[model samples]
Target: MDRNLAIEFVRATEAAAMASARLMGRGDERAAMAESILAMRSMIDSIECRAKVIIGEKGLFDGVSLEEGIEVGRGEGPELEIALNPLEGARVCSTGGYNALSLLAIAEKGSIFRPPAVYMDKIGVGPDARDVVDIRETPKENLTRLAEIKKCRVRDLTCVILNRPRHVNLIREVREAGARITLISDGDVAGAISTCMPDSGIDIIFGEGGAAEGVMAAAAIKCMGGGFQGIFRPKNKAEEKLLLARDIAPERVFDTEDLVDGDIVFAATGVTNGSFLNGVLFKPWGAVTHSIVMRSQSGTLRHIKAEHHFDRKPRY
Candidate 1:
């Protein structure tokens, strides 16, 4: 994949987020997501690239329609595999809650890890703890160790996790361990990156989310110099076959670098308020998007606040 092709994908995501953020709290998430998906699709259609949806909300083989998939690169760019969560926190956007985002990650062909569409147990650590936190350890003990490593009070540490039943006990343990809790309705992608950005005020992320997202998060963490570890949790025999069919080893433990390698770029546009970035805001003049685009090879993380003028509608 041409490294520059990543920017085109980012632009398409920006367009999608702009269209989606307008629907927040409007009592229509599917419509909002559909609009975003369409906008993304249109944008991707304009790209000059060949890409595959290696890891996306839909199963791997299902191509994001001109109305689906996270909008990727120009139609004729690089032959890349994309992992996308078009609207990562649709519920949050619908309720005007928090942590909604339009996310996408691209890797050179065959670089993305393909796991069963199952749950993944993961632990994310911030720059403060660096190599100190380990997923193999008890979550409670890891919190304590992280606090010590960071030289901060346990209460000062913030743990982020998806607000789900599976995480209830983990939340309680983190709170009991004296770490602050920041539960998100969705968007573990943002939650994972938050730990690495001190400005985001999140110190760690623990618990489970989709296996594909775990790998995507791992990619970003690798670029940001954080720590992430995930173990895949296949739900059924079919999901198990999905992995085996791909020739994926069932017992592999995926670290950040394993998900994406070579020249890599990641961009996220916030759809609702969250730790890493504020959601998109539409103004009288145009639409504004808050995004963070990072490249692992260059160690560059650019916080971009971009505006697009939709002054004229395109003619079909």
Candidate 2:
């Protein structure tokens, strides 16, 4: 993929973020998601590339989506695979909560893992401790080993988990192991990404989240050379059927490299403020946006603060 596509991708995320920012606190996630998808699709369709959304967040917005395996872009440039989460945390965004984002990942054709959207049991950590943590080990054992590698006590470790009822035993084990927990309502991708960012103060992540989110998070981790491992968890017979129909193995552990292969580019624009990136800010002149774009081949990450003047620039 050409390096210039990184900036083009950010433009889509930025447009999605700006489009959804107005719907914050409106308690209408569907509307917010629809606006973001439409805005992003408009931008993506204009970009000069032949792309397929092999992995995407679908089923929201009354069947609106970038959609898995659906064609996007201008159909005139590089062949690419796109993984997208137009509004990562719509529930959080609707409630005016933390860590809402519009983000996507790109790779050459056949590089990204294609999975049916299902729950995935996962473990994530930074580059320093990436080699130490193991998904096959018990949570307490993993935490103990991670603490040893970090040269810190078990109590000093903080793990992120989704606040779901299914995590009851997992949460108990982490607490019993003497590690603190950060429970997030949604947006585990950001939570998982935090583990890879040293200043983020997040040591590791453990629990189940969306499979699409796992791939998106894994792409960022792969770019940073961090650690992430996941296995599919189908909740019901229908879900199991959907996964099995695609020839996906539930028992296989998907590491960062397995999730995203070859060189990759990822872009994100914050819709609401949280740990790493600031949310879009509306002003009299226009709006200010905070975004970041990264590439694995060159290991370059760029933080952009863009001021959009509506009078001069038009919104799609």
Candidate 3:
């Protein structure tokens, strides 16, 4: 993929964030998601690349074209695979909560992980704590090793996890292990990526989340030289069958490299305020967008804050 497309992709995220922020706190998740999909799809089609949707949304909020195998882009550049979530946390956005964003990952063919859309048991940590985490180990054991490496007490470590009933045991284990916890409402991609951010107050992430979002988070974490591991967790016999048919072993632990390794591009624009990125701010004249664009080949990450004029904005 062209390096210039990094910024171009950010444009798509920006457009999506801007469109969705319009309905923030409006209690209309589908409407906000619909606007985000349209805005993002338009920008993606304008890009000069042959993009395939390997892991994407389908049949919800009119995002049918984002389904797996659907081809996007202008059909003119490097053939790439796109794993996208135009609206990562629609419920969060509707409630005016945190970590709502528009995110996408672009990589070479066969680089992004795709596993039948089942939930993934994932562990994400920054580069410093990378060597200490094993999903198979107890949270106490991992946290102890991490604290020893960081030269901090066990109680000083902070872990992040999704606030779900399935995590009741996981949460209890972490608390018992003497590590603080930050339970987020949604946005697994952001939750995982937060561990890589120095000021996000997140040291590690452990829980089950969407496999597609795991791939996206792995892409971002790779760009930041972080550590990530995911194991396919099939919830039913049908999903296990899907994995078997694809030759994907449910026990296999996919590291960050296994998930996304080649030259990669990741872009995200915040839709609602959060620790990682600020939400879009609408002004009397127009709006302001905060976005981050990353490229793995050069390990370059750019934070872009742009001011948009209502009448002069480009094709949102």
Candidate 4:
């Protein structure tokens, strides 16, 4: 795949973010989501290249996706795998909350696993705890281990987890461990990315989320030299069967690099407030976008603060 694909993907995500941000805190969640999803899908369709969506929400065959697995490029280039979350936190956007984003990643096809879209249990850390965490350990145990590595008190550690039923026990464990807990309603991509950013007020991310997001988060982490581990969890027999159909084993573990390999680029535009990037800010002259674009090959991270002016209000 061409390195320039990242730039193109960034542009698409920025457009989607702008559209989604318009719906922020509006209560018309379905409309806001529709606007963002349509913008993203339309942008993807315009790419004249064979691109495979390795990790995404349900596609066309499921009746939810408008165009699923559509090929874009005709040239015989590297098989490209694209992973996307048109809006990572629709709830956040609808509520005018935080960390809703438009995200995308492109890599050499077959590098990313076509895992069933099931929940994934993961533990993530920054460079400080890369070699210290294990899945079998308790959240407290991991915190203590990390504190030992960083030579900080357990109270100094900040653990992040999604606010959900599955995480109640995990959050309690972290609290009992004396580490602070940062609970988020949605946006695991932002949560995972937070672990790698020193100023994100997040020391590590633990618990479960969309398996596809694990792959997308890994792509961003790979560019940042962060650490992440994910184990696919098939919730039921049907989902497990889907995994087998895809030739995925029941108990496989994937690291950051394993999720996204080869030369790749990951980009995200904030639809709502988030740690890595700010939410889109609209102005009279134009709309401002806060975007993060990174290239894994060169480990280049670019923070793009751009303003785009349109001839008129965006229709549809």
TM-score of 1: 0.89
Off by over 4 Å in 2: 59-65, 241-249
Candidate 4: segments with Cα more than 4 A from true spot: 59-68, 73-79, 245-249, 312-316
Task: Between candidates 1 and 4, name the one with more favorable lDDT.
Answer: 4
Residue-wise lDDT of candidate 1 within 1-316, one digit each (tens)?
4566667778877877877788889988777777677676677678787777766654222244532234455556567777776777777788888888887777777777765667898888776676788787877789889878988778888888788988778888887888888777777888898889878888888998988778778878877878888877788999888878877677676777666766667778888878778888877777778888787777788888877777764311
Candidate 3, which ten residues in sequence have the lowest lDDT sum?
A: 57-66
Model 2: per-residue Cα lDDT at residue 147: 88
Each model's lDDT = 0.76, 0.90, 0.89, 0.81
Using TM-score, give the best candidate's number: 3
Measure candidate 1: CA RMSD: 3.2
Candidate 3 lDDT, 1-316, residue by residue in tens = 6799899889889999999999999999988888888888889999999999988777545543577888999999889999898999999999999999999999988888776647999999998988788988888899998899889998998888999999999999999988999998899899888899988888999999888888889999999888899998888999988888988876888898888868999999999998779999999889999999999889898999999898886534
Number of the top lDDT candidate: 2
Please give the lDDT score for candidate 1: 0.76
TM-score of each: 0.89, 0.95, 0.97, 0.91
Q: What is the lDDT of candidate 4?
A: 0.81
What shift in Å separates residue 43 of candidate 4 from its native position after superposition?
2.7
